[model samples]
Target: MVGSCSVRFPINLEYLHRTHPHVTTYEPEMFPGLHYRMVVPKVTFAIFKSGKVIITGAKNKMDIDNAFNQVYPILKSSIKITEIL
Candidate 1:
C-alpha cells in the first residue's frame, strides 16, 4: 500500500526551475507549485516557492525516507540556504 506524504521544507524554487529544466515544469498562472517527478522511486511531488513539498506514490516510510534522502541533496545543491530563509 502506497501512501502519499506532504512535507514542508525550505527551498529556492527559482534555482530548481533553472537547474532541472527538463524534469520540472513551472507555470504559476496554472498552478502554484512546481511539479517534479522522481524516477528511481517513481514518486511525484509538487515543490512550492514557500518550500512545501507534497510527495505522492510512496509505498511506505522506508520508501518515503529513501526518496527524501535522495531528493534532499538535489534540492540543497540547487538552492541557496539563505534564499530559503
Candidate 2:
C-alpha cells in the first residue's frame, strides 16, 4: 500500500471527502491522530479492496511521516495557517 503522513492539526475532512470520494476517513484511539485511506484501481500496488480505503494503523514515526506528507500539501492549500513553528 502507498503510505502518507500529516501533523496533528485542524482540517476540513469534508473537503478531503470531496476530492477523494472513494477515500474512507476514520479515527482510532490507538493512534494519536486522524487517518484516511482510499483505493484507486489504477494503483497497482494498492492493497485496498476493490472499492475500499483503509485510513488507520499509523503507530510509528515512519507511518506518521508517510501520512503527513500525503495530507500536508492539501491542508496547506485548502486551510488557513494560523501559526508555524
Candidate 3:
C-alpha cells in the first residue's frame, strides 16, 4: 500500500539528513525529497522539504498509520522554525 500526508510545516531536510544518516537517503542533485526506511513496519517514506510525506511498501492502513505515528515525532523535532514578520 502507498499512502501520503503532509505535516503542513516546513522540514529541515539538511538537518534531518545530518542527524539521521542511517535510515535516510538524500541526494539533492537527483531528488528533492529524502528517502527514509523504517524497520518494524517495513515502510519507506519520501519526505519532502515542504513536510510532505509519501509512505510506500505498507501492507495495510494499520501499517501506514504505524509508520506515520512513528515518523511524526521525528518530523516534529525536525521542523524548520522560521521568522516572519
Candidate 4:
C-alpha cells in the first residue's frame, strides 16, 4: 500500500489553464511545470506544458486509475486509451 506512477502525454497549457484554473498553479521562476492535486483519489499530479505527467501520493493502482479516469476527460473531450497510465 505504497507507491506512485508517472505518465507522458501531449496537452496545451492554455487549454489546461482555461479548463482548470482553480486546481493548478504555474510559476516559471519557481518551477517549469503546473502543479495539481486531485481530491477524490487523494493524488498529486505534476503536469508539464510538454504533456509529461508525474502522478504521486497514490496508495494503489486503483487510486491511479481513479485519478486518471477523473482527469483524462477534463483535458480532452474524448478518450484515446493508448499507452499512458
Best by lDDT: 3
Q: Rank the candidates by lDDT, best first.
A: 3, 1, 4, 2
Q: Please give, for residues 15-81, the per-residue lDDT of candidate 4 as tens digits.
A: 5655677887766678877767788888877776556677888889898888877876764531232
List, residue by residue over 1-85, the lDDT tens digit for candidate 1.
Answer: 3444444456676677778887788888899888888887877778776667777887777776787788777776745554545
Off by over 4 Å in 2: 1-10, 26-35, 38-56, 80-85
- Give the TM-score ranking, best first: 3, 1, 4, 2
lDDT of 3 at 11: 84
> Candidate 2 on 39-78: residue-level lDDT in tens?
3222211111122223344555565455555645765543
- TM-score, model 1 to reference: 0.74
The best candidate by TM-score is 3
Error of 3 at 2 (Å): 0.4
C-alpha lDDT of residue 46 in model 4: 75
Enumerate residue pairs that collide in model 2: 4-66, 4-67, 5-66, 5-67, 5-68, 5-69, 6-67, 6-68
User: Which pairs of residues collide in candidate 4?
Assistant: none
lDDT of 4: 0.66
Model 4: ten consecutive residues of lowest lDDT: 76-85
lDDT values, one for every candidate: 0.71, 0.41, 0.89, 0.66
At residue 30, give the lDDT of candidate 2.
46
Q: What is the number of backbone collisions in each predicted candidate, taken in the order shown?
A: 0, 8, 0, 0
| Predictions: Cα RMSD each | 3.1, 10.0, 2.4, 5.7
Q: Return the TM-score for each candidate structure.
A: 0.74, 0.42, 0.92, 0.70
